[model samples]
Target chain A: MTYLLLFLAFLRVGFFSFGGGLAALPLIEREIVDTYRWLSKPEFLELLALSQLTPGPIAINAATFTGFKVGGMLGAFVATGAFCLPSVLLTLLVVTFLSRFRENPYVAGFLRGLRPALLALLLRVALSVIQDGIHDWFGLLLSITGGALLFFGKIEEIPLLLLGGILGLLWYGWR
Target chain B: MPERHRHTFLLFLTFLKIGAFTWGGGYAMIPLIRRELVEKQKVLSEDAFLEALSIAQSLPGALAVNTASLVGLMIGGVTLQLAFVLATALPSFFSIVVLAFFFLRFRELPLIQAFFRGALAVVVSVIVLAVWQIGRKAAEDSVDLVLTVVLLGFLLVTGIHPLFVVLLGGGLGLFLRR
Candidate 1:
């Protein structure tokens, strides 16, 4: 029953979590943390940390972590599997339908129309994540520095991540 | 292996590689997929890839996984598409599981905590970059700019579920473009 609930929980994440993993957070928070109580908010934040460090999509990683905590190894596998299952099926369906109706107004309209709204949705995600992470003055300054370096400075990503980890170690570890 | 089997195998391998290397998420994976599938593999041209990307971006789910599903369907059929999805999901699936196993056990170590705190900050910056890139392109002209602001206000104020926000956007899209 737990596994079934886990599958269904992640199924909703797969079906409706547009944009990406960050965008999926609010919904996942609502479903798993609030509704099911599978994990506490603090535990969820830890999973968020894990999701970021681990490669691949954030949503999938979170699912695996929660699944493991709730139902053990099998729960982890089932939750991760169930998370992606819907999207895979839906992707195929949409691709097939779109190809055959490439010129259809509705399809074209949907694409043309979704732009502004999607932008806002993504913005909401960006703002939310930034709001969550930047707590102290140093954290705020770090994010500003990170954002500036990434966008304006044109620094490469790997080194930036390394520098960030070092800064965090020096900052948090020392304090 | 049969020719079909070989193609499917190669497709799976290609996605496996993409899934393994990508750090930021679906949007970050887009360029990598473009390089391999469009530039090298020549399974899809740049234009077709972009078009599929457009559709994939709007749809719910991970864009990388969705894009793979689209590409796999075009190259082969349902079976090939599903194979690609599984291949794509597998690397992240297994890697996260392994990492979580270790992370949970050793999380209390000061070094681990420091590293995560730092790594996570950078990770968020990567996300900010992704959002900025899209916002630049998406927020063209006054209509788009206004819609973005209005919707931002609406979501933040109303506290509506994002699922509904997205669906409402779909409807708004039809009207805005008209």
Candidate 2:
């Protein structure tokens, strides 16, 4: 029963999480944190950061991690499989039947409409992450400087995360 | 190994390597896919890859997973698609499980908490930048701008589930002909 719920929950995440990994944040937060109470908000944010810091897709990471927490190794596999199932099924559907789907005007219109709304969703998430994630002056400074660097330069994500980790150790470890 | 089996195994290995090595997420895998599949192995032409990317983008689910599935389907069919999905997802599945194990165990440690805080701070910045970059391309016109604001207000003010909000957005789009 627990496994089934996990499957259903993540399946919803897979089907509804359009756009990509970042766009999936609010939905994931809803199902996993608010709906299921599987992970707290702080833990969810940590999962998000960890997913970004590591390799592969964020959705997959979230599924596996949360699944492991809820049910164990088997749960992890179940959740992860549920998350990937949509892409596999949808990919097959598009390839076999709807090759011209993207070129369709109505489809284009729907996507164009979906785009800005998605932007709004993403913006709301960004604001909340900032609100929940930043607690100290150092954190604010780090966010501002890091965001500036990312916007201005070609800097990659891992290195910045690594630098942040080191700065954290220096600042918080001693104190 | 038989020739066919070897070929399938090699294809699986290619995706496994791509999955394990690439950081950031699905978008990050594109260059590697282009390099390995398009340029190196000659699995598919550039145009085909682009088309696959478009199709992948159009679909729901992870962009990386969707693209990999399409490429796999193009190369071999359902068999390769299944294999590709497994290969692509396995690395992160294993990596995160291990991380989660350690994270749960040592999460209360001061050092871990500090690192978590620090890392999360940077993640906040990354997300802010993503909003900026994606927001620019997302709003194509004044109508879109208004829609964004309206949707955001609904999301923030109302207690409506985001799933419903997403549906409402799509429903509005179909009618608006945006």
Candidate 3:
């Protein structure tokens, strides 16, 4: 039952989560935490933290982690596979069509209209991250400093990300 | 070189690099994509860059994957297009599978936890930087800024699903921007 639920839930996430993994969070939170009772709020939060820490999409990570907790290794496989399946199929279809209509003006115009909306969506997601991740003054300062360095200093991203982690350890460890 | 071959090779190389380094999902991929597509490939001009960014946002799947697919289609032929999508997605797929395979063992490592904490902080910073850059480019006027702020406020306050906001914003952009 849990495996089936995990597979179906994640399949929905895979299909409907149009923006990205971060955009998928509220929906996942609703399903996993609010609807399914698979994980509590704090556990969902931990899952998010873990997802952020690990590689891959957060939705996939959350699916795997929650599936494992609920069922086990099989759950993990089912969840991860279900989560990614839509993307694979959708991309294949899009590619197939694009191969033919690559020059169609209507397709181009639709994409043109879609662009601003995408920008708006990305901005919304970024703001949500700031809201959830930065919980205190130190965290806020870290975000600001990091943002400034990346924006104004034009520091390479790898180093900037590494610096944030180091600062997290120093600040959070001492506290 | 034939344009198709050039685009395909570029797509493969770009996504391979993104896959290798990007952790913590799509936001992390944004700057890298910007660096490569806009800065390196120069496939998209400033206006087109903005357009691609918009499309990637409104449409679905992973942002990195979506951006790669569109850019791939635009710059390269179908072969390059598929290569770019694969390149962007394959890294995350492998990484997650590995993590899942070693789930129990990996979960217990204190050092790993510490590393994650450090990396997460950095990821946040990287996201912030991305927002700042995107805002500078995307918000060209007061209307754009208002739309951004209103949407932000709506999300923060009402806890509405992002998809709805995105749809609403798209309608607003179409009606207002034009």
Q: Highest DockQ: which candidate?
A: 2
Tens digit of lDDT per residue, candidate 3, span A70-145? Answer: 7776877787667766665555565556444424555444433333444556665455556566666766776777
How accurate locally, in lDDT, is each candidate? 0.75, 0.87, 0.63
lDDT (tens digit, per residue) of candidate 2 on A113-174:
78767887888888889999999999999888888888888577888888887888888888
lDDT of 2 by residue, B18-128 (tens): 999988877888788878889999988999999999888877789989998999999889999999889989999999999988888898899988898888899998888
Two-chain DockQ for each candidate model: 0.57, 0.78, 0.30
Candidate number of the best TM-score: 2
Worst 10 residues of 3 chain B by lDDT: B112-121
Task: Give the TM-score of chain B in candidate 2.
Answer: 0.95
* lDDT-sorted candidate list, best first: 2, 1, 3
Candidate that beats the other on TM-score, 2 or 3, i.e. the better one: 2
The TM-score of candidate 2's chain A against the true chain A comes to 0.94
DockQ of 2: 0.78
Inter-residue clash pairs, candidate 3: A18-B60, A115-B54, A115-B55, A118-B57, A118-B58, A165-B118
lDDT of residue A6 for candidate 1: 94
Off by over 4 Å in 2: none
Using alpha carbons, what is the TM-score of model 1?
0.85
What's the lDDT for residue A8 in model 1?
90
